[model samples]
Target: MRNPLSDTIVNIPPSGIRKFFDVVSEMKGAISLGVGEPDFDTPWHIREEGIYSLEKGRTFYTSNSGLKELRQEICHYLKRRQRLEYDPNTEVMVTVGGSEAIDIALRAMLNPGDEVLIPQPSYVSYVPCTVLAGGTPVIIELEEKDEFRLTPEKLLEKITPKTKVLILPFPNNPTGAIMNRTDLEAIAKVIEEKDLFVLSDEIYSELTYSGKHVSIAEISGMRDRTVLINGFSKAYAMTGWRLGYAAAPALILKQMLKIHQFAIMCAPTTSQYAAVDALRNGDEDIARMKKAYDERRRYLLREFRALGMDCFEPYGAFYMFPCIKRFGMTSDEFANRLLQEEKLALVPGTAFGNCGEGYLRVSYAYSLEDLQKAIERIKRFVARLDGEKKC
Candidate 1:
């Protein structure tokens, strides 16, 4: 049989986080802090709306652009929360999730060999999606000393004549680093000078603990240049609902909808109804969940530091990335050893990028009881390593 995979298919690596997660599954009493998902179930109101849709037999496909009402709600939500405006009819498109929105946007915008500036220690999907869309990913390292932020200087250095898009993964995954208005304005200046487009993943926008979330689209000229990507997954505990949407320039959204029309037809009709409710009636639920996560986030950061791992205080999201260099083991080695010896699972930071070396990403989405247990076990594991002088 001839090998059937395309060149693009053959080149992509599997998700690095899944490796430890899979191994941890078979272990007894394994405490996992590796999941990048909210611990809460979708709120009753949201779930009730989805069930109501089903009872009404509204399972038919929506337009490829999704329910107009949902898009309008998204526009309101964005404007109210982030102060970024978009015309719901022309500028917004509902997607299966932020993942599909990302894939479709990249496909619609890029041609073969166009360079995409991606910051390292970001979510894993961006690079692969760029490649699949026939774009080249140029990675810029975001250092811990800089609070894992992508600087304008670093972004400027990576841009070339071929550069087509910049992926800004903020309120960042794995690292939980966020950009304030000052940081964003600096980045906007560079993008304006370079005439670059932006794919801003703001899925964690509502999860910030230290400050209010600021969207790059809020900047004067950047609104038209930025594609705002967000989802019900993180903020509303709707990960399993698989609902997301994008706010983009009308022209780009039109192109993206064409691709979406051919490939996906529409996002789930039932989920769309639920998402409308989520966007409109779910603020209390969001606030409640954010409070719980903030508590857990603080606890885990303290636990990790007390265990002698040097870590950055995450400002948003539910993860902590702590440098593991003192243990003298690569992230992969340390992660594997922790899983095997302590039966605790966390994602190695290297899974995000090479710049993520010497760190491990621990998610605090688990309950306080579970997190406390995992921390104690991890502390003992580290102490044993010291006793054996194995670090």
Candidate 2:
């Protein structure tokens, strides 16, 4: 009856993106360009594998690290795509989505007051998870001019003697930004020289619109010090499958698996079986979905620019961070008005971090038809704002 909650947990804020989503859910005839989910179904082949697993009654638990087959497939997939190698037996572990991999990795590594350098306008889970892991979250604000990438200079500015980890959220979420090889090499040099470890969240690796996605773990000296996290959710339209993985050095993985062993037991057996199929046969599915997403991304950029809205052309992820500063409203205010007046929902950029002020994260994962409808509404809404500015 005394203190019901820990002060630490009580002080953390809820996700800012959910507020608009909850409102849009109840509003009639609302169109949402908010949620970062694929419009496509889990490809028929992938779904069939899950059905087959259930039909075969493979419903029991897999090993805590996951079905050996799925882990090995994950290793092969990474090697094929990223040129990275891992021992499936000791270096890989399946998790309950990338979120779990993130949580357990932080728990395995951090001690109280260990500073974690996190760049702004990144996935919301990083800061909260770092805090829960007993690490102090040091925010490094990424610049719009830098395309929301974490620059080496900016990263260096935040590092302290207590800095223990850097969370690299690239092919970034809200901003759709990606760090090319040169961009990464510069940052990797700093990390190596500073002797800092990394938590590279590459869940969107398969969704990049430009050249191939590069993992910081691919850097010469970094894999041993990096935990590479990825999953099928974004890549395979397998969100509900709840399967993800982490490939880390055996020493670090041993500790992470210990936490996962007690906390999660294992990822879903059916999902694991299906994921092996995905890793093996889903490359075509990924390419197909990415093609559609890129088309939508380009269409939205053209529409936003044609309306004279300032939006940077993003090269990765399915979200677009368009500046709403010209409308003279804060992101939350503009998004709120857009939802009320037009029944169109988008995530306020500030939902990711303070640096996202004056911007909105528009997801292109919705269909081209849905995107066209949403744009008509946005067009109308912005026209009125334009008229008001002139008056």
Candidate 3:
């Protein structure tokens, strides 16, 4: 048989974060901070809604765009929380997860060879999704000095006639970086000037420790060109439910819907029903979970500082990207050694992007107890490395 794989697919590297996660899974006593998943279970009310739907025999496929009630609830949630309004009937469509929304958005917008500006050290999906959609992936390396926030100047340097889409992954995954209204206004200016579209992945929108998350869709004139992707996973702790939605201009949404309708048919019915309840009555759950994550966030930062590690104070998401450059090892080496020597599993920063070479991404999504243990092990590991260097 001939070698028969799509070169594009073959060329895309596997998820770097998952590599260590798999290793940790097999180790008996490993404490993993590798994956980006929320550690909390779905709130009991939300879970009960799903159970209720199943008992009521609502195990049928919804409309290709998803359940009408769920879509409307999504619109309401976005408006109430982010101050961004959308026409649920035409502009919003639910998908399997935020990951699918991202893939389909790229497929809907990108023509062959169109250029997409991706800020580096972002969620792992953006670059590969762009490539698979037949778009050119143009990386804009974000600086740690700037807290990994994408700058308008960096945006300008990357734009060309072929530039079609910019992915704004805020409340960023590996780095926990965020862009405030003023920061987004600058980038919005550049996007508008360049006549580009945006795919704003605000999955961690609810996890910001600072001020509220500002969606680019909320920017003046940006809603028309932005596809806002969010979901129940991070905010509602419904990762297993796999429900997400995309809100964009109806014209763009129509094309995305075509791809989603053909590819996925519809999101799971029970999940949609649960998600409707989540959107309608889940604010308290969000507040409670956000408070927990915030506490863990502060604890990790203080612990990292006390251990003399160069950690950027993350104000969003559950991950901390701490610089491990001083140890004179690659991020991969540092992560591997820590795991081997101390059974602590953290992701290498380079798993996010090449620019992340000298850092490690430690997720604080674990419980405070687990975090405390991991920190103690990490402290010991670093001390040993320091002693070895002195020798």
Candidate with top lDDT is 2
| Candidate 2 lowest-lDDT run of ten | 16-25
lDDT for position 372 in model 2: 98
TM-score of each: 0.98, 0.99, 0.99
- Candidate 1 Cα misplacement greater than 4 A, ranges: none
lDDT of 2 by residue, 1-391 (tens): 7988899999999988788888888999999988888989999999999999999999999999999999899999999999999999999999999999999999999999999998989899999999999999999998889888888899999999999999999999999999999898999999999999999999999998788999998877889999999999999999999989999999999999999988889999999999999999999999999999999999999999998888889999899999988888999899999999999999999999999999999999999999999999999999999989899
Q: Which residue pairs in candidate 1 collide?
A: none
lDDT of each: 0.92, 0.93, 0.92
Judged by whole-model lDDT over C-alpha atoms, candidate 1 comes out at: 0.92
TM-score (C-alpha) between model 3 and the true structure: 0.99
* Per-residue alpha-carbon lDDT of candidate 3 for residues 1-391, written as tens digits (9 for 90 to 100): 9989988889999999888777788999999988778889899999999999999999999999999999999888888888988999999999999999999999999999999999989889999999999999999999989999999888999999999999999989889999999999998988888899999999999989998999999999899999999998999999999999999999999999999988999999999999999989999999999999999989988988887889888899889999988889999899889999999999998988999999999888889999999989988998999899999
Residue-by-residue lDDT tens digits, candidate 1, 1-391: 9988797798799999898777777877888988888888999999999999999999998988999999999989988998878898999999999999999999999999999999989999999999999999999999989999989889888989999899999999989999999999999999999899999999999999987999999988998998899999999999998989999999899999999999999999999999999989999999999999999988888888888889889998888998989878999999888988889998989899999999999888878998889888888988998998953
> Candidate 3, after superposition: displacement of residue 54 in Å?
0.5
- After TM-score superposition, the amount by which residue 19's alpha carbon in candidate 2 deviates from its true location, in angstroms, is 0.9
